[model samples]
Target: MADHLPPVAREPAAESGTADEPGVPRPATGDSGLRRTGARGASGPRQAYAAIDLGTNNCRLLIARPAGDSFVVIDAFSRVVRLGEGLAQSGRLSDAAMDRALAALQICADKLRRRNVHLARSVATEACRRASNGAEFIERVRRETGIALNVISAQEEARLAVLGCHILLEQGEGPAVIFDIGGGSTELVLIESGPAVPRILDWQSVPWGVVSLSETCGPEGADATQRAARYQRMRSLVDEAFAPFAERIAPARADPPTAESLRLLGTSGTVTTLASLHLDLPSYDRSAVDGVIVPATAMRAIASRLSGLSLAERREVPCIGRERADLVVAGCAILESILDIWPADRLGVADRGIREGILRSLMATGLRRDGAGALRTGQDAV
Candidate 1:
């Protein structure tokens, strides 16, 4: 199945940070007193917002409330359904994949309803962009689940990805390279520094992603050398596609103007799963993984380890279960190639992405403000 998660029960405490104990929900920042007080016409018990990402491999949901300068996560869900499993070979959306995605969307709708989310945005990524019958499937979702899904463009995808991972830009003399490896495509954006705003100097969306690569070039009963060569060939393709973008950002590399250094910030299934594996955790742990840096060498080492394993052996790795074992290597190859093209001391890991970007944009706009001076839109709100 294409990676999609059908909606499930809301767990408020898991995101709030107070529910550190197993099975308890975390205390969300919405309950914290740190929310900005100056927004105009804003009055409320507290505004609840939601963001949903329907990707090629998974469907994810995150609900949150504004906290200080940043917001705190309140509730979250993610499921892998492989919505783009055969999109590379078939131009049309597969009925089976749509069913999986639609089911997941229903769950998201239920969660949004249960959370009483006042403002929300849900986006469909590469799979939806490429499928010939993608629109029809979207209409079906709205009719069946009462959820509106926006099929975002690749450019918008890169922009939202930046918004989600901008925190990394603040840490160093940064002209950071940000990329997301999705199920059907990969987005790479190179941000160059300005005194006031960092500009995206170059961006590209490569059609090859985990889903496509796995389907197109996966081992599939091949000999060991053949599989290795296929992996290498895929990596070379990614490298070739990335060349133009790299050259465009070449000037920034020679003389990074900012005090903060240029680094890579990755937001995708591949990097996050790798982070989980790095910690050797059975399940994903945001605290242990997010914001951590994996050196380029270490990342290659991890990929090397996985490349050597058989499918079953790869599944034995903590972060990559059977569901992802087949595609993980493809993802790793893409990441490794990107990093090798522009060697960075550290590659930042972000569990957050487009969803967080949407919420940040919404609250900043006071779209959910219920009273005067309560949640007035910020100047930065787009």
Candidate 2:
């Protein structure tokens, strides 16, 4: 959501080039490593770590320095590269999509170079994981941008997402369902959160993200009557995908929490967009939207109204620009399906996720060496 960041997935480091899972190994680092800012007249090296998430729909980077207990942002960048634009049917990434993604990675490479990031990790999600030439594209990125992008599994993606954004879960003992509606796939994690990072008791990765769904389902209908039929079809598609997951978790938590204890948290473009519209923001404001809780009924109303509108009409809405108008409705469809499965009264919105998880994982070691004991708590200026 623009330059504004979520109170990031307040989790830890991740790894790539080493494991199929997201781990905390150096991502964009050269042999030189990060500069210990003694050269800058600071007591310790102004070491920083970078995490890039090359999702099907967006390319996001987060650079930060360790704070006392957590980390603080230094510099960040994100772009709508639409890497999975047509992968649903083609089973291969288009040249245009790869080019857009490569261009964005180059920008990230430049930032990591300028910041002298010590340890970093970059990951590719559903788009790359699904593409036939995904490996070739990763090699090209390495040669051109010098950023090794690891195409992680849906399970790893789900784990990292939860690792990054679980902090936003409402404080209740009852199991909370945290979902990340991504571009090509949606990750739903059932968590038993404790004092520390949330535990993933079970998780599911449904292959119905905005990009893939729109490509398959087509338009949101031209009029209200058609729109209703289209919406039901979309809902049914998602519902079927979710049915297996529902059965698996159904009996696990046989004694479900009451309305007061259950929490539904969503971290994705769809949820944020709906929250922004519900708040009547002329434009997206991460500060106002991140970690904000909105009533499920309000979000349902917003999605219904959006479902009834045509593509051109959706483009008229403030944040639903040309790039997102078509896909946002698909996202709404996914959100509505989730709401039906987990009837939480209020939904918590998270702006942070994958990147934040990487930072937290890497910082587990970086924090010990950050030397900026004073700078540990805040590095927003860096």
| C-alpha TM-score for every candidate | 0.83, 0.85
RMSD of 2: 7.6
Model 2, span 190-300: residue lDDT tens = 888777877777889999999998888866666788877877788899999999888887754455655555688899989988888888888887667777888888999
Candidate 1 local distance difference test against the native:
0.71
User: What ranges in model 1 sit over 4 Å off?
Assistant: 1-45, 193-197, 256-260, 367-382
Instruction: Kindly give the stretch of ten consecutive residues in candidate 1 with the minimal lDDT sum.
Output: 1-10
